[model samples]
Target chain A: MSINRNENSKLDFLLEIGNIGSGNALTSLAEFIDRRVDMKAPRLEFVDFNELFGSVGGVENVVSGFLINVHGDVNGIMLFLLQNELASEVCDILLGSKLIDLNALDELHVSLFKEIANIMAGSYISALAEMTGLKITTSVPDLAIDMAGAILSVPLIHFENVFGQILLIQNSFSVDLKEYNSSIFFFLEDESIAKLMKQFGIE
Target chain B: MGKKILIVDDAAFMRMMIKNGLTQNGFTDIFEAGDGQQALDMYQAERPDLVFMDITMPNVDGIQALKNIKAFDPAAKVVMCSAMGQEAMVVEAIESGALDFIVKPFKIDRVLQTVSKVLG
Candidate 1:
């Protein structure tokens, strides 16, 4: 299947997939916490490299991030990020205890966050696979709690010469009257995006 | 003593969850491996009656481990437990000799039923 390579069409197709992926993530998280997870409409945008760090509250914002490589029929990078305050609250709920410090996360806390990343990203990829009839697998997630710029730079630096804009989804969801924000970034080259669109018979 | 079972996943929390679930239900003999390589070694060392394997890991993956264990012991009973529940993975695991596939965020009852059915 040959993709038409129309830029707007490609962005539209990606936006559609982003909606599905974020929806799947929200549903999965709700089931994980066994709570009502309500999400605002996800914003899918293509941001230039200079604006990328600012999208997540500047380069120095301390946040928890997880990166997982997606492979098989379609290849890309999946990133999930949460601010430190939200991360701490989430840890409290997930770990079933109040955490005194977000700076020092025990191994168990890290493992839980990694699992959450796995589950959320896996849910998105699973939905994509089911919809496109493609085989998609994810790597075990690598996590970090650092400045947003530092975390975002990993992919940016890797694909600096290859990609001009990064595809990002800003997802906001509330649970039990507390609002939490997260962002999922997909770093795929033009060729990969074309390959993904081709599966949907988008011409 | 119940039949010995092995749980393979990189996440310690996940291993603990499954372990707690099984122990609460009277399945006392449970073993754990952090990755596929460890799973292979533990499988050989413990000769666990059933294995719950995760698909993605660092050193080795569940699919490769499942293949290795099947090669070592054709009678091996393995079930895939992972968050990646795509059709392709499920089919691949089954083709590679997995007896069953259990998607993550699963219910304890479902895990118990798979264990009972496979071990019985």
Candidate 2:
């Protein structure tokens, strides 16, 4: 749980990268939703999969969800959560109509979240790629309705430290009218971690 | 001549955001729509030279609206607006005949640049 001096530096690098990525994501969200979003970069932590799951009190229901699976020399995931009202507001903004119904889960809602996630994650990964000189490609974002638990329950087994455990990076953000929370949970294989450390000039 | 632009998105805040970007860049006579259905109706009525459209909504989506507009105006100049992680849909929009795409949390510079390019 406690990172050493060298590891601390590496974490700092990741945090800085995450900060830029989050900033890019926030800017995109603001434009798309037409609302100002307050974004915060939380203190970075390294936790085993079990500890991560236990710390967050598990995933909860959300109005809209955007998730991107990041793959490359450095591996992890980026997730964006939006409250239903906010999601409807975003849908309204995007479609150019006030007719968006915020109360229901429908195909339109799912597609909107997928689009938001795509833009946010794409902007984040592009920023990261620029910083690290790495090529990153994300999977086609999957849409879900009231499926946070289903998505979180499925374990990510990429990291060797906790095979089948989910290592989570929890972060928070808020839009003008509503508050939102999101996380990036991934298991990095030892090789990936080693490469990440070396890239950060920690090795 | 300055291009006539359509702003479609349900949120007033968002409509204002795109309107600000366009007006600041000297794009006047901008029109607005709240949903995909309205967007289609507006396309038929006003037939603006350009559109900055959001991808998600209640009655219809940006993609569907984009397709509908394109179906009506094969020469329609439509730009898809999306938040993060909607790359695939963006691609679909482009293939469906959108002139280009813009990602949101709108950057003044990015929006201006995309508009200038499309107009040019």
Candidate 3:
């Protein structure tokens, strides 16, 4: 079941929405560091859950991820993933603090990283809400500092009963003379997708 | 407490972020609550001069908590700590009783500015 084949215009619509979200997220991130963050055009796609691992190098890559379940007008899971070391660097840049070892994380380190994810995810959804005029509320964010595949598996599996297709937005961000990449995966339930399409009047 | 500031959020980290910014900027008496219910209780107990709260949380959200505090103390100084996309809720908070609203991933300068403006 190819989402593009059935809903070409819908994919385009979501791509634009994703672009707005990615742009907004980068802008907020830039503010966090009090510097300009460069962003590339966001790439949106629909792929199988298992293939997600292959999209970001391999399933075994150690990464930091934030999972949020969206409720209200539409229901879905949103995942924010970035490489582990880069996640720590993001903390360093955003907090104006440095870590002795990038791989190691203390309680505060994890908290800071999770807070960053929270803001990014919040900004992403905020753009969607504004554009579609939907009442969207996000749940408490769950952070996983582990293999990318393992962390994403939880939400991907949770949506298995309801959805097979996953929509991902890859956003490239560069700040403070360094570049880091992150992806936001939006797995909407079948009904949720219908609600979103109806809101935009997409057939 | 002298010019106490109350920060509310489910994420301990977010509270820490706000507290860090305020403390660095010379806010001595700072209080924190994990949710809206606790924020209401703390507001009643502490009667802090300013309240900074997140719009979303587990037990009680920022909006309901703001309303509760405003009803309890009509002159309570409340500032909503909202995430970017919560424009609607921010508006509702302002309409209810919030002095102003600040978006998250907040800079210390912006946070301080909001606090000062609210104080004035």
Best candidate, TM-score = 1
Mind giving the per-residue lDDT tens digits that candidate 2 earns over A70-134? 67555656555455566666656666554355445455555556667766777777676666555
Task: Output the number of the DockQ-best candidate.
Answer: 1
Q: List candidate 2 stretches off by more than 4 Å.
A: A2-6, A41-43, A58-64, A92-104, A157-167, B1-120
| Candidate 2 positional error at A66, Å | 3.7
lDDT of 2 by residue, B1-120 (tens): 567888997655567667887787787888999889999999899989888887655578788999899889899988887552344555678899987777655567877788778877
lDDT score at residue A79, model 3, on the 0-100 scale:
89
> Candidate 2 chain A — worst ten consecutive residues by lDDT sum?
A158-167
Q: Enumerate residue pairs that collide in model 3.
A: A126-B85
- Give a tens-digit lDDT track for model 3, residues A58-78: 778777888888888878888
lDDT of 1 by residue, A1-203 (tens): 22345577888888888999989987888877677888999988877777787888777878889999988878788889976666666667767786667677788888888888898999999998888888989999999988888999898878778775567899988888888889998877677777778888985
Would you list the rank order by DockQ, best first?
1, 3, 2
Q: Residue A63 lDDT in model 2?
A: 36
